[model samples]
Target: MKSVNFKKKLTRLFFVLLGVTLVYQTGRTFFLKQEWQARNCAYEMVKLLFPDAWDRACDQYGLFCFNGSEKPMQKCTGVVESGSIILIHGLDEPGLIFEPLALALHRKGYLVLFFFYPDDQRIDASSRLLFNNLSSLSLAGPVVLVGHSMGGLVARHMLVDPVIDYAGARARTKVPEISDLIMVGTPNHGAFLSRFRLFMEIREQCLLASDHRWHRLSGFIDGTGAAGIDLLPQSEFMRHLNSLPYPGDVHCHMIAGHIFPFPVNMPEQFQMTGNQTLEGLLLSEKNYFLSVLGKAGLLIGDGLVSINSSVPFNVPVTLVKGNHKTMLANCFSGSSRIPPAIPVILDILEL
Candidate 1:
C-alpha cells in the first residue's frame, strides 16, 4: 500500500515537471529560431555608437569593425589605448550582443575593443585570428579580456597555448600580457546538448548559413568547423583545452547561472556538494532523453552547460542565479537584473 502511494506521488510529480519542460522548450525554440533567422544588425549598432563609422560599415564584411577610428580592413596602426577591455562573444552571437556591457564599462572609462568572428570557426582558427590581430595592436598598457561562452576558449588559448597555428596560420608577434581573464557562462567543458543528434544537425546548418556567399547567394558553419568541433561533449578540442591547467600568472574570474527556481526539492542529478544550494544551476526537467543522457553522470547546469562543465577543474566558480544567456546579459537594458559577473569583474579590475 505504501509503494502504491509513493508511485502515485511520483506520477503526479512527473506530469507537473513535464508541463514545465514543455513550456520552457516552446519559448526556447522560438528564441533559438529568432536568433538564427534574424537579419544581421551589426552595422546599425556601430553607426549608432560612432556616426563616422557609418559609411565604413558597407566596406566591412559584416556590418562594422571595432578597429577603433581606423578604416575597415586596413592595418590598425594605432597604439593600444590605455584602460582597454577586449570583449569576445560566444557562439551564434554578434559583437553587438555585448552592447550593454560595453556601455557600462564605458561609463567606467574603458576603451572597449569588441571582436566579431564567424559563428562557426573552431577555437584553433578563432584563436589564430585573435593572436594575429592582438600581436599587431602594440598595446601601451595592460588589458583585461572578457569572454562569453566560446570566447573564453580563445582567451584561454592565449594564456596557455598561444602557439597553435591552425591551417598553417601563425602569430606574427607575441600577444600582449593579459592582466585578467573574465568568463561569463563559459562552457569550459563541452555542453551536453551539443551531443544531441537532431540539435547537432540543425545547429550545423545554421552555422553554415552565415557565409557571405550564403547571404549573397542566399546560404552557414556546421558543428565540425574550427570552433563548432569544440562544443561537443568530451570532444577532442575540449580534451586538449582542458588538459592545460589554468595559467597561474593571470587571474581568471568566472560567472554562471542556474535556470530552475526550486532546488532542495528537485531531482537527484541536481544534488550539489554537502547538499549545497542548486539555486544557481540546475535544469528543470528529467525526461527520458535527460534520463538516458544523465546516465553518463551528467549534471544540472545552466540548461546549456553542465555545472561540471562551467566549473573549471581548478579555477573557482561563482554561481549567479539566472540562465545561460541572461547571466552575461547584465549589459542589456531589457535584461533588467544586473548580472553578478559585472560586479565581480569590476571589483577584480578595480574599475
Candidate 2:
C-alpha cells in the first residue's frame, strides 16, 4: 500500500529509538556504579588514616609471614622461617602491593604470604585459591610464587595442576607446593588493548561489561598463534592456564609491559612474543628463559612490565624507575616517578 505503511512506520520508529537509548544507557551505568562505590568507600577511609609510608619496606627487604589460622595444625608464622614467599596481586589490585615486597622478604628471613583473590572471579575460582593455598600451607623451602595481573594467571595454576588439593584434597593424594614463578603486567598474550576494548562496546558504557574475555580476546589476538598466543585456547581463562606442564625445575618467569604509543608502551612485538622469540611463538614446554628490561629507553615498562616482558628466567634483567602502576603503587610515590620494586625484590632474592 502506501510504501507498506511507511515501512511499518519506519520499523516502529527504529525500535522506539532503540528502546530509549537502552534505557538511558542503563541509567547511566547505575549512576556510574554508585559513584564507583562511593569512591572505593572513601579510599578505604584514607587508607586507614595514612598508611603505606614505606611500611618498613617489608623489613628493609627480606619478607616473612604466614599466619593463616582457625584450627589446622597451627604454628604458621613462617614455619621455622627460611623459605616461603607468596604474593599474587593484580586485577583491581590492593593488598598493599605486597607490603614493600613483603618487607623485603621479611628482611631476608623469608616467609611472606600476603594474599587476596576473587577479583570478579573466573579462572576457575582463581585456580582454586592457588591450589587451596598450596596444599594447606606449611611450605618453607622451594615455594616462591608471585603474581600481578590476574596474579600471573593465578601463578600459572601452580604450574598447570600437577595436582593442587582439588577442592579440599578431593580424595587426598594431590598436593602441589609451587616452586617459583613471577609475572607482572601479565597478559600471557592477548591484550593488545583487546581491540580498544571491543571498540568501546559501541559506547553508552558496558565497555565489554566486566570482561567475558572481550570477544574471546578479540578472537585469540587475531589468530595464527603469534602474539595473542592464539588467545590461550580461547581462554576458559587461558585454557585452564594453558593446561600446565611447564613445571620441570620450576623457576619460570615472564614479566612484560610497554608504554610506547600507549597500552602503556610495552610492545616490541609484545617483547618479542613474550620471549619465546617469534618462531611459532612459544608459550611453555618446560623450557624457560626470557628477560627484557626497560625504562623508557627501550620503550619503558613496569607501569605494567614492558622491556619485552620484564625478563628473568635465564636471569639478567634490570633498569627500573616506575610504571606498571608505579611498580605496585609506591616505589616512593609522588604518584609515579620511580624507585620501588622493593629494591628489585632485594636483588632477586639475593641468590
Candidate 3:
C-alpha cells in the first residue's frame, strides 16, 4: 500500500513538472521574433502527444526516404540540345524554388536537371552527394553547373575536391567535361545573413509549408545545421575552401546583384566646419563617420553579400539591377518583367 502511494506521488510530480516546462516553452516561443520558433514549439508539443506525428508528416511530404533512395536530382523531360545544365539551389531551398529557371532552361532545349539536397547538412556532405548523383548519370556532352547562393559553394567543393576514396584504395574521379560554372549571387567569401540563420530556417519552413506536397513537414524540427556555421566569413570551412585553388579546367563566372545603384552622398551641410572649437571637431568627426558608413552600404551588394564577397579571386562579375531574391525569375507573381539574371545566364550558357 505504501509503495503504491509513493508511485502515485511520483507520477503527479512528473505531470506537474511537465506542465511547467510546457508553459515556459510556450511563453518563450511566443516572445521570439521569428514565428517559426513558435510554430515549431507547438509542433513539438503535438509530437510528444502523438509519437507517430513526425513519421506521418514525413510520409505525407514523400520525405520518408528524403536522403535515401529518393534520387537527389530531378531531370526535366525534354529533348536535349545544348547539353545538360544542372541547376543547384541554395540554403533552405525546398527544390521548387528552381522551377522558374529550370523551366526556362528546359524551354531553351537544354536538358535541365535540378539538384536537391538536405541543405542544412554540411557543405562537403552535399557536395559529395552531388558527386555521387553525377557519377550515376551518364551525362553526354558538356555539363554546365549553375549554382545560386550557397549552391555555388557546393559546386565549387565538388570541383575542387571531387575525389572520394572508398575501402581498399578505390578512388572516384571528379565529374569530367565541365563547360562553365556560373554562380548567381554566391557568397564566395561569406554571407552576412548567415548570422540570422534561425530566421532563414523559419522562412524556408514557411515556403515548404505553403506547398501541398510539403505542408506536412511544416513542423519538421531541423535547424540551420553545420552549413550555417560554415557560411560564416571566418569559419574554418570558409578559410580552407578559399585556400583551395578553383579547378583549372572549369571556366568560372559570377553574376552579382546590385540592388542599390546610386552611391550614397552626404549632404553639403554635413561637411566639416573650419571652426577650431571642440563642438566643431565633434561635428566634423560625425560627418566623416557618416561618409564612411555610406560607402559601406554601397558595398553591401544584394543586401546579403558584399560586392567584394561576390567577386572573389578576380572572377569576372556581371552586376544586375535587383536584390538577391528578385534576380531570380519571379516564381509566385508571374511578373512580366524578366529577371535581370536570366538574360545574363542565357547569354553566358550560349557562349
RMSD after Cα superposition, model 3: 12.9
Could you tell me how far off, in angstroms, the CA of residue 116 lies in candidate 1 after the best superposition? 1.1
* Candidate 3 residue lDDT tens string, 78-184: 23334878788888776665566766776787767667666766687778777766665555567888899998998888778636421111123333367789998
lDDT of each: 0.59, 0.46, 0.65
Question: Which run of 10 residues does model 1 get worst, by summed lDDT?
Answer: 214-223
**What tens-digit string does per-residue lDDT give for candidate 1 at 12-87?**
9999988987686455444442432232233233346555443342233221225333233333455766677888
Q: Give the TM-score of candidate 3.
A: 0.67
After superposition, which runs of candidate 2 have C-alpha atoms over 4 Å from their true positions? 1-83, 86-103, 112-145, 149-151, 154-156, 159-184, 188-190, 193-322, 325-351
Ranking by TM-score: 3, 1, 2
Q: Encode model 2's per-residue lDDT on 1-351: one tens digit a residue.
A: 999999999999999988986686456444543544454454345435444522321222222244432221222332334366778764444345555566556666776665554333344445665675566554545666778655776666645565553423433534434556766566653343322222322321232233222333222111111211212324344555555445565566554443443222333332233245332232332322222221233334444334433343343333344566555456453444333555565555665
Give each model's clash number: 13, 41, 0
Deviation from native of the Cα of residue 172 in model 3, angstroms: 7.7
User: Highest TM-score among the candidates is held by which one?
Assistant: 3
